[model samples]
Target chain A: MTVFRTLAIAGLLLGYAAVTSAQSAVDEIAKYRQQLQDGNPADLWEARGEDVWKQKRGPKGVSLERCDLGLGPGVVTGAYAQLPRYFSDADRVMDLETRLVHCMVTLQGMSLADATKRPFGSGTNRSDFEALAAWITAESRGTKMNVSISHPKEAQAYRLGEKMFYFRGGPHDFACATCHGESGKRIRLQDLPNLTEKAGAQLGYTTWPAYRVSQGELRTFQWRLYDCFRQQRFPELKFTSEASIALTTFLAYNANGAAFNAPAIKR
Target chain B: MTQPRPLLLVLLFVLGGCATPTELDIAKQAHEVMRASFKETGQATLDRLNQDLAQSACSIPPSTSVNKEIAATIEKENMASIRYPADGKLLGDWKSGERIAQSGVGKQFSDDPKNASGGNCYACHQMSKQEISFGTIGPSLLGFGKLRGNSEAIQRYTYGKIWNAQAYSACSNMPRFGHNGILTEAQIKDLTALLLDPASPVNQ
Candidate 1:
């Protein structure tokens, strides 16, 4: 009788294990799609961003509505796809955020220091920047990235960014290569994209200005670079510094031809 | 006869020493090896070689479980370190917060020491939906505001959690944003707004 009881228990345990294993697989797939379906919270920021763009309030009493995003002045439709391009006015290459800062300062009469100090989504002051960026990025949701690296400065920034990507340091002797240079690498269950590759670069770079669920916040490319430094145990990245801009140029150039899906939702 | 006994005892002692190293001994050896492999540089002193209590505790092999009391103590200690904004305000501009969260710069040997640090929250958690590219070390935070309305309690919790994640979860891999001074109070407030603001992308 005891032998029979043990056999029954063992059989039950085996059956339970099989069922749970199958269930877990199904659950994982469902979770992946569910994450996709949630449709990123950045949409909310995009909505508010539209309002901020049209609202006229700076010292110049002008809205960003008349600002050009590469296509033409006041034409935001599909403009993000062709950003980090040469702007004749600035006489230099500028990404979306940098261009927006210029507009906020020049057109709005806001001080560059005050505008930069506020950060992306903090205070009523910088909130407009986030909203504007979100709205502008959304207009080009389906457009492909076409960053111009032909210019000397653009090319220089790209090369500098490449150098920065491989540079190693910190107590752990880690580099960006430690986490993202190689394909098929992951920490825990998450996969790390190989930013060096075209597909990886496209997937990684084109999907910035994302909303993070864990932190419950919106993040821009500049912030993304800043965080990478922190994890590497590096000192700190200044806001919109040259290094930051250079890295953006490198990533943007690599993401050429990929769809612009900024202000994305992330897990 | 006495000499033979002593010789046999010595042999046994040597044999016992040959046994595999204990966990503690292995850890010590590993630490020593790491120390030998790295050299100190500017601002990033050798002290960083030493793991804090939380890091040390978490470093233990998975085969062993942390004692509940120790885990609770660590959590309590980390929680105590969290500091709220000087003003009662918890939320700031989600737009600026987004920049801080997305930034993965700061705290590198190559970086200028004078610059401020960043939170790099996206490295672990998925806060926004629009950013197709993100890591998943922690849970996804899409629709965080939609699910949990921006209540005062939730705002405080978000601030506290970002300030010191260990306060909420004992051995969380998340960094201590406020505790480490990686982010300022204003930065934390912006992050909070990014997370909880109805108008922020995270909520949408």
Candidate 2:
């Protein structure tokens, strides 16, 4: 009985080894990602967002054509690449989501509360902000990131953002730098990009605004920041807060020369 | 083969002195901006942003390395925070330890306040040979008991280290499971046994 049991265990181990060695989990995930790249779901969001942008449905019944995004006004192409820039009218640094909210409020006559009601999508409740951001960011795909920090406020935002990146807090005492400051480091299998350097910043910053397969939702850079703070064990980051804009300014400025490459798919 | 340039040295020193204040100014601004941006939610209050001396020292910019002197100071202070079991018992049921090591839940804002916390050891360690799924953030403890033996000192060291990882290695990425109130003394004992018990899967 002992011999038979031993043989059964050996056979099971051999079978498990064959199954795992056939294709490691990482390889399988990579292959899956490659396949997913063929037909990204972000394209669907882009179409939906384009419709939202052009459709006149707000209380003011105005299209967002007059809303400027650091490019004069009504220009969609290559505008996102220069965003999170200083807008003199607002006298503040604004990322794409904040700018969109501003346009929704000012142009479309939407209340701030109403505009930000559904900032993220889940299940059947799709977010207009996320879809709009996906479409707007897609407009700048393949353009080199050219975010300017020449303005005094823009420069201040960048500096503040850099500081916040290193700010440690919470029970765990983790700053963004803890996970992403070093080159050639990863947490588990997730490759943490070093946001302080050019190569890492470019790769990390430019490729975001991605379609997260796990969540099945389009995530904006603001959503990205909000979620990161949650994992960092910090309190909830207010949407489009000063710190959010500042951090976005810092990261976007660092990604100055890389080509914008999303709405891309991510695992 | 170059001669000493006293004039050049003077110029360099002046430029270096001019650079320091700007950096300090920016750092002050960053601190204020961050303070204004976050809000309290659930158990994560705004006070979490306030750094203790050890935390501030360890929170150096990525461009800088951890100062050895400061790190050592942090280690010394953290070592003083360890509270051994009052009854002096160190070992616990390794079976319970396994469960604590496997669970990665606790202390997040989203977690239930009343529920007991977990050590989440598997998130950054290979505690047992049987568990194929483990993170690589920290070292593997596959043969921990066989290698370290079940000495009284080993048991005590294991318990204390799990209680406050920073006690041994300052600024360690590992959480202060006990020191930070993330785990109970009983939970920590189970984890220590997970590493030092002869009958534990880690020993096998």
Candidate 3:
């Protein structure tokens, strides 16, 4: 009887120690992260990005300062968090960068083809766009994401985006859902966020225009989408295509209440 | 039959020596073949074929368990390579970061050589709720700031992980951004804000 009692006590002690150790391990990781946060490297991009925003260029020799970001003409503050909204002039929902392109072409007299064809952050045109997008997004740093889908077009785009997200047809027989639709999934060591959830939506949607340490260059949202198709072995998604816009609307709507953040850094 | 015993033994020995290829050997061969088959084109050059230690390690078959000692060594080596910003700032313009992450241009065979590279983060991560088109290789970073809070430590982790994912995870498939020079420091800062800033869409 004594031997059995002693065995039970030992088992209980082992279980307690195991649980405590697991919790402590998690805490240790968190603490380690904290220690490293004193200096972040992303400030350099932000500074240059701001400079690029105000510089004047293009055929008309005008800057994007006078451009309207839907809030008002020449107003850039707090515009990013409320993007993919309805635009009466364009008669469609427009995100920040696309709308900027329209402004640069129309207001600044820059050719549409020149503006669109320039690769991201390549020539003066693309650089201007990146800087403008960066500065404007920074202005709305604390704002919540509120993409309006009140318009019929907005609703249609959202639905289309949803369909696209789930549509599966590629060489690998992969769909976005195959990787992101589930919770607690990971590729190697990277954690896979569940896009269907609120927290996941916020985490997934708001961080972009990020720096890629691997490529040694800044990237835009359009490029990000295009790469997804590439990895999926699917046909490329044209820059700022209807499919792209619709998908943006869907994600924005899903992240209605989440805060906005962009131009982030990544490995 | 007794006289043939030696011959039977020799036949058994020969049969035993013919073993199947080990998983590691098979992986190595496949990697070598893949490296040899591709040629450089435009910005996408043959140099991209080279695999870092992390990639090479991951190419091997996954057994029931990973040797903890090797994993630790990989992580330590990668961690030692992480470079923090010269100045002490992690946050940047979320707007610009958004564009960078969204773009999938540059570094392709057909791409213009003059153009700058893009992060293509959306291809692997869901960043903003407003942007619907994104990939799923990595996790959704939306509300990252909100959940974890924009503490200094979280910012550091974000920067370090993005700079060299292998530092955090020995065999992570995620690319080493800083180690490979894939993005500039400014771009990294902007992306950091996108993930950790309270006002950014990710935190929303």
Candidate 4:
């Protein structure tokens, strides 16, 4: 009995030490984020995005100033918070990136291929969409996410997004829910947000268009989905496709009531 | 790689759905959207969108649920697909297994498909007590062999379970590493030893 008690005390000490180390890592990461938050590199992208939005460089020599972002023409402020909304003109639901593509094609006289030539950027090659998304999403800093689902098409998109969220496929047979379905879960120290729950949904959805420190690029929501699909072993998700918009709509809608805050920083 | 599944598996998956025709239609439409929205890149192809019996059965949204009855059928099919090692050797070098477990290089579109894939066991599992930074998605495997003695039966069970977790639990989140070709027979053998060898750090 005495030997067993001694062993139990040793186990308790070991467990406490483990907990301390894990806590320290988490705390260190938090501190690093706080430090990085003061001078986020997303600011550079925001500046470039704003300039491009106002520049007249396309074939029609027109700026995207007159582009409608579901809040009427050229209204940048607080527009992203209400995105993935049904557009009567397009007759479909579109997210921020898709909407930007539409504006580039229709208003700026850019061809579809040209508009979507580079949706993501590698080092030294910047994506216009990322810049535009950074500026546009930055404009909606504290606006409450209030994505609507009133129209039939909007409702359809939401339902489709819901299904896609749970759709299992690919070599790994992973769904978005596979990683984000449960609370208090981690994937090699990276905390996964439970997107099904309200708090998790809000936290996850509202913090995209982040400046990924590792990649040294400001990534948009569209990029997030594209990269997730790549990691899931699914084929490359199109730059801005119907499925991407649908999934975004679902997540954005689920994130309703939380204030949208992005063009943030991430490791 | 998996053997071509019997046609009956698809039928069982369809019959397993408790959702109404409307819900099924939504799922179908969602599938179509996915099919149309993805293009082949690197090792990932459009064929990745294809769902097997277990995938279709397990893909229940928050608003929906899976059919437990279908789980048995899925498990049976997956169990039959698990091939044992040719030499009947279930365990390999635990040192190599430790390296495999630590590595997360596999199957991503950015990954080189020509190269060997890692088990990436540490990403979602706590395999060794010494590895302080471990994931919590899956159960801890510390002292796995110590807790469950390394009998011949245990060796076979560990090897098979790692090969295809779905063979045991129909909708298990653990990847079908061996069945899906994410890990080779040799790699899986090494992983088996990592989990069940008495001298392995996991058992220590």
lDDT scores of the candidates, listed in order? 0.68, 0.80, 0.63, 0.86
Alpha-carbon shift of residue A24 in model 4 (angstroms): 2.5
lDDT of 1 by residue, B1-204 (tens): 011133332332344343233433434444443344334555655455455555454443220144465567668888888887777999999999999988866656655668876677776676766654456556789888889898899999999988888788765656677776667899999999998998988877
lDDT of each residue in A139-242, candidate 2, tens digit only: 99999999999999999898888878887767777788877787766454456788889999999989878988666777989988998898788888888889
> Which candidate ranks first by lDDT, i.e. highest?
4
Deviating ranges (above 4 Å) for candidate 3: A1-38, A122-126, B1-204
After superposing candidate 2 on the true structure, give the runs of residues whose Cα lies further than 4 Å from its correct spot: A1-23, B1-22
**Residue A72 of model 3, lDDT score:** 90
Off by over 4 Å in 1: A1-30, A122-126, B1-204
Q: Give the higher-DockQ candidate: 1 or 2.
A: 2
Model 4 TM-score, all chains together: 0.92
**By TM-score, is 1 or 2 better?**
2
List pairs with backbone clashes in candidate 4. none
Candidate 2 C-alpha lDDT tens digits along B84-130: 99999998889999998888666678777788877777766777755
In order of lDDT, best first, we have: 4, 2, 1, 3
What docking tier does model 2 reach? acceptable
Worst 10 residues of 2 chain B by lDDT: B1-10
CA shift at A191, candidate 2, in angstroms?
Answer: 2.7
Clashing pairs in 2: none
Question: What is residue B65's positional error in candidate 4, in angstroms?
Answer: 4.9
Per-model TM against the reference: 0.53, 0.87, 0.51, 0.92
Candidate 3 TM-score, true structure as reference: 0.51
**lDDT tens digits, residues B1-204, model 4?**
233254634454477565676877788899889989999888887878888887877888531255666777788999998999889899999999999999988888899988888888888898887786788888989899999998999999999999999999888888899899899999999999999888999988
